[model samples]
Target: MTKTLTIRRPDDWHLHLRDGDMLRAVLPHTSRDFARAIIMPNLVPPVVTGDDARAYRDRIMAALPADHDFTPLMTLYLTENTDPDDVAAAHADGLIAAVKLYPAGATTNSASGVTDFTRVAPVLERMAQIGLPLCTHGEVTDPEIDIFDREAVFIDRVLDPMRRNHPGLRVVMEHITTSNAVDYVKAHDTGLAATITTHHLVINRNHILAGGIRPHYYCLPVAKRETHRLALRAAATSGDPRFFLGTDSAPHTDANKLLPCGCAGCFTAPNTLPILAEVFEQENALDRLEGFTSLNGPAFYGLPANDATLTLVRETPEIPAQIDTPEGPVTVFDPGMPLNWTV
Candidate 1:
């Protein structure tokens, strides 16, 4: 059996580092492993303009530990009233990596998201003209649609139409959870890709509902059936450049997570690497781990692969039950099995 493996330091294609105290507590975990991360802009007010992205990037840099050498590749949260000029300038200045699209009410703090897709046509056109990528939350917020079916439905109802209209636009289907999403990406010849989260690769909907309501296991675009989990694992470990790692490691205090209507997210930043190593090892596809976690994302975003490397040793690493933050203790995601690799 292989004992030690080393790969280029990875980048997170999708990440949520909430502002203020939560940001201070959680930023270190990701910085320790990832060389750069596409920071999500769905804050309380949301980062909607070029100025907003720049200011948020400054806060991320201020919060990062002095010893950690990490870069925050920022993004602007797209809204109905968003200025296409601001987005274009941000990308032109290299101030932001992508523009995020969240359907209104789709997930946490998404009340400010786009309700009318057509209203954002000008922004999408400008993005296409400049080669900027649009990162989508990938779920429709229709109350009638079953949560489990939202992702697949979004492809048909929203995403396909948008792509068909703006053929030149590049899109990243963020934190995708189904085989339908996999097939969609495969069907597309170019200008389309998907990001698979570390948590989604391990847990299915049953993980959240089986014995009892496991709030820590619950997340937006909630984990799907076992077959879907298998498909995500296959795609992630397939060495396909179109699929890559995006640990949607969102943090919610234990207090809020256990509420009657708890928030949706899994705090997986700290242990993503070790768990990914175990999953790839089980599939006997360790050779492809580097591409999924490190290389593919940069290629899609037009950035260079990280020069430094991370080595994982074949030994179990202790995972804390929870991480204590000033606001409250945030539970870390448990893969529900022994992980034999540690970075």
Candidate 2:
């Protein structure tokens, strides 16, 4: 057996560290394993402006542990009324790494997202001109569309046309869950990429719907059929630069997740590295693990890979069933299988 493996420290291309007590409680889990992360901007009010992103970044820094060596690469949430010039300036000053696009009502805290895509054409054009990447939620909120089909439909109705209109715009299809998404990304040689999450690789729709309703297994861009899970695993382990790791480790308190209409997310931050190592080892592609979790993301974002290294030993890890927070207990994602790697 391959006993131990070391690679450059990974970066999360997509992450959600909710503000306040939740932020303080969860920030350490990610910083412990990752050297940096692209912090999601979908707070209740949303980080809409340069000032908002700056303030949010400051708060993230304040919440980070003093001894942890980690950086929060911030992003701004896109709204129809967003100021293109402000976004450009934020990138110029290195205040933000990217801009997030959430179609209104697509996911949690997304009410402030863009409802009218046309209204943001100017912003997209400006982003393309400056080579700023647009990280997208990749779902359409149309009530008529089947929930399982939202991602594929969004590509046809929203993403494709947007890309067609702004040829130079760089886009990251964050937390993609469908093979259609994989094909779309493959068709485009450049200016397009996709982020696959840890939970998605291990679970499918059955994990959430079978036997009983497993709330902890539920998440936005909900897991699809088994075939799609296989596709994601293939893409992530393929050593393809166009696909990379983005845990999308959204945390919701157990109270919030068990309600009649529970929130959608999987709190995978605590054990992502171990779970990823297990997945990569199973695929017999341990060689590509570094590219997925560490190198590809930085290259896609035009940043340098981390100099620090993380070593994973082949041993089972003790993962908590739940983590405590001020509001309530938040369940850590259970990969539902034994993980034999620990960092």
lDDT of 2 by residue, 1-343 (tens): 8999999999999999999999999999999999999999999889999999999999999999999999999999999999999999999999999999999999999999999999999999999999999999999999999999999999999999999999999999999999999999999999999999999999999999999999899899999999999999999999999999999999999999999999999999999999999999999999999999999999999999999999999988988898999989999999989999999
Let me know the TM-score candidate 1 reaches against the reference structure: 0.99
- Candidate 1 lDDT by residue in tens digits, 1-343: 8999999999998999999999999999999999999999999899999999999999999999999999999999999999999999999999999999999999999999999999999999999999999999999999999999999999999999999999999999999999999999999979999999999999999989998999999999999999999999999999989999999999999999999999999999999999999999999999999999999999999999999999999999988889999999999999998999999
Q: Which stretches of candidate 1 lie over 4 Å from their true place?
A: none
Each model's TM-score?
0.99, 0.99
Model 1 residue 115 CA deviation in Å? 1.0
Report the C-alpha displacement of residue 265, candidate 2, in angstroms: 0.2
Q: Which pairs, if any, clash in model 2?
A: none
